[model samples]
Target chain A: MAEKPKAFGERYMVKPGKSFRLADCDPRAANGFSDKDAAKADTVRDAAAIDALQDKLYAEGKRALLVILQGIDCSGKDGTVRAVFNHCGPIGVKVQPFKAPTADELAQDYLWRVHHACPPRGFIGIFNRSHYEDVLVVKVRGYAPPEAIEKRYDEINAFEKMLSDNGTKILKFMLNISKDEQAERLTERIEIPEKRWKFNPSDLEDRALWNDYMKAYEVALTRCSTHHAPWYVIPADRNWVRNAAISRIVRETLEEMNPKYPEPKGWDPKTVKVV
Target chain B: MAEKPKAFGERYMVKPGKSFRLADCDPRAANGFSDKDAAKADTVRDAAAIDALQDKLYAEGKRALLVILQGIDCSGKDGTVRAVFNHCGPIGVKVQPFKAPTADELAQDYLWRVHHACPPRGFIGIFNRSHYEDVLVVKVRGYAPPEAIEKRYDEINAFEKMLSDNGTKILKFMLNISKDEQAERLTERIEIPEKRWKFNPSDLEDRALWNDYMKAYEVALTRCSTHHAPWYVIPADRNWVRNAAISRIVRETLEEMNPKYPEPKGWDPKTVKVV
Candidate 1:
């Protein structure tokens, strides 16, 4: 009898040149990549590479990337952001969450507040919830008129396009947790004394409107997922899997961007003797 | 020679405990407790702990913490918050920077907007700039009358006292960088092309009012420092030192709080079996 295949990490280690698409490649089949063990090993190696690349990007200070995360209630957007960017350099990363707008914020165009939060060049900014909310939540809750909501779709695409033109890369991730998973998590919050405070009675109310939210997200993704600012639908049932997948995607994106360290102009290394 | 006191992690080769204090420790010291190295290491470790703790706290439904960081501009408050808490759990950690108030904020009592931003128990919230700004910047800029400024200080102390009475742990850190250091950092920002964007021409105008700001801070600290909630003066001249010191102090404080895992009242661990 043939022995069971070893994990991917066990079979082969991850190298620098490899693409970070583990979900796309099966590890067990003959034509596939290495098995699960090898993949785990690859992930560890990839994490280090991601760290190095992040440092390079930070040092170069060329262009910045804004990552907008949008999803329904209990969708794990915040968790994914933390896990994915945990290993990245802090200097170039900023996370901003948009709560209910203040009177000042309401007075300005929806994008006005968001543009101010944009990360500087060579940095990464994550929007826990972003302007897309104007179209999604506002539309779902009937807060904005239909015409205004419709106009926002074009405005978002154009806004993202402008960012791209200005050398800013944008990536949007929509965490797609199954209803069962979200309910289970929410139930856990209710059952655990420590977690009880996190349970808002209003979350159940929001859950009732889940379908509307789903539709809103579907439209948002369809309309806003442009070439400049693409969206990835991530399955977030298993926390470990979600973390791994997001890390892989981010690593791949940075590798593709090929961030490099900017050389200090007019520096004569020969003049500085190294003992 | 005393054999370098058998360096803790270096010579002893012990897996160092993952905790730190930033206020009193030197970051560059030989032990893993050095300000800079400890800060980085503490961040990675605390990130995981904070993640688990937040989930537990959220589940338990406790009151949240509001950590107010106050310092002169360029004192490294932003950098400290970024490095130390970069990996902290989920969106449970919210950073609110209180800039010059808008017309609405100005119209209300100084604590009005701040009271709204204070985290509910069980969450760890940070104020990059906080209610103290009403006393610090406003007073320094002569935005309020001298008597009004004095009253605001008394009001702030009372507000923070109420928060502590209600389970909020207020950890305020004043990143105390020397004037010379600030000058050096500002010069670096101006000289480096990549960092030119970070240097706002208006910052010089603010720099000119350094003495006024310092006096304002001294008054705020002296008035607000209490048995329940105290201010920690953190030396911020060295980046690593500041990071380590803050991380250590934060870690120690949390440990002292002894936030424990709350059990589900009726759940039996023995009966829980993996399917």
Candidate 2:
């Protein structure tokens, strides 16, 4: 009974079965943080904490932490990763960035690549974009029929629940950026010489249907946010705010898990000596 | 041509179609470096250089580096990874450690799981152990018939050639440690408090067949070392020497690749402005 209660981001968690609306969450909200520099400092500390905790988790070698980041273009998925995992060693963490499904991927069920990329035990996996895209982008673009899309919500939920049951703790983050914020970011990508390579014209098409994507995201967040795997809608308009919030929650969740390095069996350290 | 020649570790690479002998290689040879401390410093610098080159490689997203490490138990495979990749980010490097094939993996051809785990473009994939095991352990243990074992060398060579044709550069290392050194390391594993968890009683069984394993390695290396995918025999009696040699070779290979940040297409940064 000494173990801490399971961690949940009550501040941003989309309650299961609740009436959810994307518009109700303000993308620019800073969660009461008025100072940008101060929030950035907090994120730095949280990142270091996550790095330390990850070592213990790896040494324990019993479970995994799967962090899923889902957002529209220019919402800063890559930026969040750089900010939050800057201190974490690459040894125990893997970042799997999902793009449009390849021909091989399309042949399999939607979750095939996803299940394959799930973090092995004792590792942390970051999905830059994830299975939720099957419900979000695929739904908004009508890549699948309405009936097929309807079935995916439960299917994804069940898939994730199974992962949770098998010792993978899942944290889903919806990087909720306002359309105006996204427009500025997209424009910045074109203007900045270093960022120009990332500015794809196709992103403009996705921007055009922002409202439809929002509704799709709303359904995904509402239906898939279960007790085992919750979705936190991060206010990602400000880079510092987004980094601070996600890192805080991630570090807190890892601390709650409280993984410990296991003791060696059938060997007495007092009697053993390297010669 | 302005490009430098493709990098090869002339010191250790097994020459194709040449009379080869594993016995001719000294497991304790220092490769001319006398000072362990000096060698360790070189490895540190090489690790940093590798880290910087890896960023450009990831940016280029054109090819992959597959490093295969093969050795008997307690041969310092894990130690080499830690020393060489200390500075590289997890974003661009993936370490896939192969243990015994599971039921699902055994259901497919031996290379099925290996192909599935091949690094995608712009990443370095380290196989702690690899497909070479199918020939080595299976051959020495007599798990397969002599004819079957004989055919695998050619099958593996053809498979590796196909991979090289498609942009995967392969480097294979056999961590050659002396029987005396192996005994010391095995004893140390049992005696050291931190390393006790790694000591397995079954490793002793393999040690008993050291001569057989050596002959098997001799045949495989002589037959399968190809132009596209070369095997290197590393003297691993000294940890610092192993790290320095491997890191130097790896850095040279990456430098030869000389990956660049790709130019953006259809976007003019000079005219673009954030609005």
Candidate 3:
């Protein structure tokens, strides 16, 4: 038999206690797969495997998976979710998209909303954007004082460690797209009538500060990519590559978790009769 | 030109202001279909159509759909959701299963949690079991006073009406299965080790009160079914027919909702250029 392919989770993961730079990674890397069509087919197969594994997770009902997707605008967070989890049933998978916080949300610490949205045991919760926004947007926009923003990386690490201790596995993906690729996508949004609604003028303001966002992402990814929750910088310039890489990582992680159907205690099926 | 088949929503809907009897509806009814395989195939096609319509619903971001499923033990609520919504992306569809209320939930009105769980505009929220439990299990188990229980039907009607008035269309399904069918299913749950975790012994206790539960459902369906939120008594003993009938109704209702991508205002695509 051919040697097993290396797991994407290990290949793309941001290793803890290591020197890292966002610029060192290629946004358009194919991650070893050369053909787009073949990668797409593998993505579909991996997604189906994820769905099957999710069924066992649901049946076991003892642990949970929390997937966090963070990226720049038009980086395909939504598209990756649709491609990777399309085969998983709604019964077991949830997607929570974090946009602007409400007045109630802003009243509390930043993690309040994110914690409440975390998947309970036996479910897979995908965060479209997550608590890292506190570090990324807040640092870039100076929403918080520099001192407060600087302390959040440790706070986030501790929080994720607690969830890990409690049986909730976390996977974070930062969809890395080239500046040129983002420009093409933003342009397409303007030109396509059906896609026009997604085009926001404010996105251009952020586009001007791309370098600042990149620096913020680098700091966040490097500081918080701990053993409990690692961040993968997905090469997202190509939708197929992005989907395939994430799907493989997600499938491999679920397989490693290996949730099983629990045996009924002290009940023999032969003895139990429905009246 | 071929005349279109009448929508399953109209065919199975329990009309408001009409006397309804649960006994009159056959648990094994295939609606109009005779062949199980063909009906199953149509169900798969309808499910895909629902997914396509749901994409438009998400893009429109102006309206929502809430599907409420109420059923006794072994009536196949989970199975129906998996079959009808397997094609829908997690981004647009959510399944909220309402078990026994928590102490905090019990502190508020029964409608409080249900209201909070209602899908925001641009999404489909499915309740595996819902506020009807206040009228079903609560009534059958004598969890509330007769007077308190008596008022919930109208209160629920008003609550659903308010949601409908605020851009959330509601579809309620009562998964009706014969007593014999429930017994068979419950038996299988005991015999299959993979399914054993789902087999709770308390389910038998509820099964014993089958008649009372049936009466409770009849009253709730009769009193709470309204113009804004009609109740559909789905014949659910046969999983294929149950899936087919409900998928047709869900798709037809979404098609009628006719969500459209919004036309962008002020900015012309021709004038805007990506930097």
Candidate 4:
């Protein structure tokens, strides 16, 4: 038998698997879309298609989508959310940021607050920061005991499984921006007066633990990626590539769901005419 | 003073009011816009503004806005949400419909679930139906004892006041569809095949108890309308009028708040040159 052909993401039909890897696709590579010009064109087209599909999904109100953006601080999470969801409908979509739990939130089970905030049917919910914080930040910062951190992985898996079983389509994206890229972005923020408000001194402290965070994400993704809910490791150093990849992923997922307006049972269009 | 100026809506500047009467501003009247036409235009405009505002707010990581829509059944609650928020940005706006409380919801305090769902700052939250359900439906349906129903009004006032004090700009709209107009609409729904899905057999039962619901709403509006949080009585008989009135109220409120993009402190725009 001939050797298995190498995957050419641009020319080849990329069959979606239980999980996807951006590094494998390497959207930034010269061969990916012939040249930069071609890639940019593809990105615009992809973005438009995603917008259309999302609008149709909103109107139909058949499926609910959950997007989890996981990455280090300054990994372009905010920018990604803005660019990807800019053209989508507001009524059916929501973004929930999971920061440090409050006294009240801490009193409940970790997933209780999250369950309360889950998007209803026919909606899209984006978790800017998510439950992974229990394992990642709490683990790295020693806010929770080691035993507790270890247990949370199982809890997260169960939580996600329940969501999938209940018709939630989950797409987790980990924005992988290199340390050098992050430093450059942070410097630009500081040097550009208009962007100074985005800077926080504490982010530098978090940067020191970058490797720890990566390891945490790798383990999280490995343990949590399933047929119903999958994680995509997106190369986020290039904003255009990041946006294009996310748009494509979202479009592909939505296409798989094939959401359509449900005609009520026994309804006959011929029975009544529009006035 | 000159005879209190005939208390007609035309005499006023049409500035957004916290409260008003439905009969005074019917859009369909021979005036420039019938209530229905006006409401439609307002819905389009409000949807666009919300889209723009949501992007800015989400990026800024500021506070959230909760808009509550309360009206009689068939008073265009669903229609208003569908129209007014049709073009809004996806990331920051969320709409929740509080249907018959599930066993889980009933177990908690009346506001427990609602407080948990309030959008984070810089976001927009819409309640298709809201906590007012407790006062309106429970009272009308006799779900709660009279004493409990009476106490809920105070609880609602306090809860809403707390939301306003905490930076949630609450704009509640009570769609005042008249009895005759509702009958006409219900007839149209039954006659039109496409609209039949919207009509539930139970609506007829609810329709029979209109006066009871109206009384409960009056109480809710009187008690809950405060300095920070206010209610607007929208004429629902004319869909366009109601949409327009609600949109104008929101626009005026936002303008009053003056939601400017927060300039980064200590940042001089002149000093930062774009590369």
Among all candidates shown, the one with the greatest DockQ: 3
lDDT of 3 by residue, A155-182 (tens): 9999999998898999999999999999
User: Model 3, residue A97: displacement in angstroms?
Assistant: 1.0
Models ranked on DockQ? 3, 2, 4, 1
Q: Candidates 2 and 4: which is better by TM-score?
A: 2
Interface RMSD of each: 9.0, 3.9, 1.4, 6.4
**Positional deviation of B205 in candidate 3, in angstroms?**
1.1
Model 3 misplaced stretches (Cα beyond 4 Å) = A1-7, B1-6
DockQ of 2: 0.26
Give lDDT tens digits, candidate 4, residues B1-275.
Answer: 11121122222222233454333645244233445555466568776776666555655665667888887767898677656665564555677778898899899988888887787787778888889898888888999898988898778878877877777877777777777788878777767654665655567778888777777776677776655566666666776766666665665555555455566665454454322
- By summed lDDT, the worst window of 10 consecutive residues in model 1 chain A runs over A8-17
For each model in turn, which proportion of the native inter-chain contacts is also found? 0.13, 0.32, 0.86, 0.41
Q: What TM-score would candidate 1 get against the native?
A: 0.60
TM-score of each: 0.60, 0.81, 0.95, 0.71
Better of 1 and 2 by DockQ: 2
Every prediction: chain A TM-score:
0.82, 0.96, 0.96, 0.84
Task: Name the runs in model 2 displaced over 4 angstroms.
Answer: A1-12, A15-62, A79-94, A103-109, A145-151, A177-188, A191-195, A235-245, A260-275, B1-8, B17-45, B86-88, B178-196, B265-275
Q: Model 3's CAPRI class?
A: medium
Residue A156 lDDT (model 3): 98
Q: Estimate every model's Cα lDDT from 0 to 1.
A: 0.66, 0.85, 0.90, 0.68
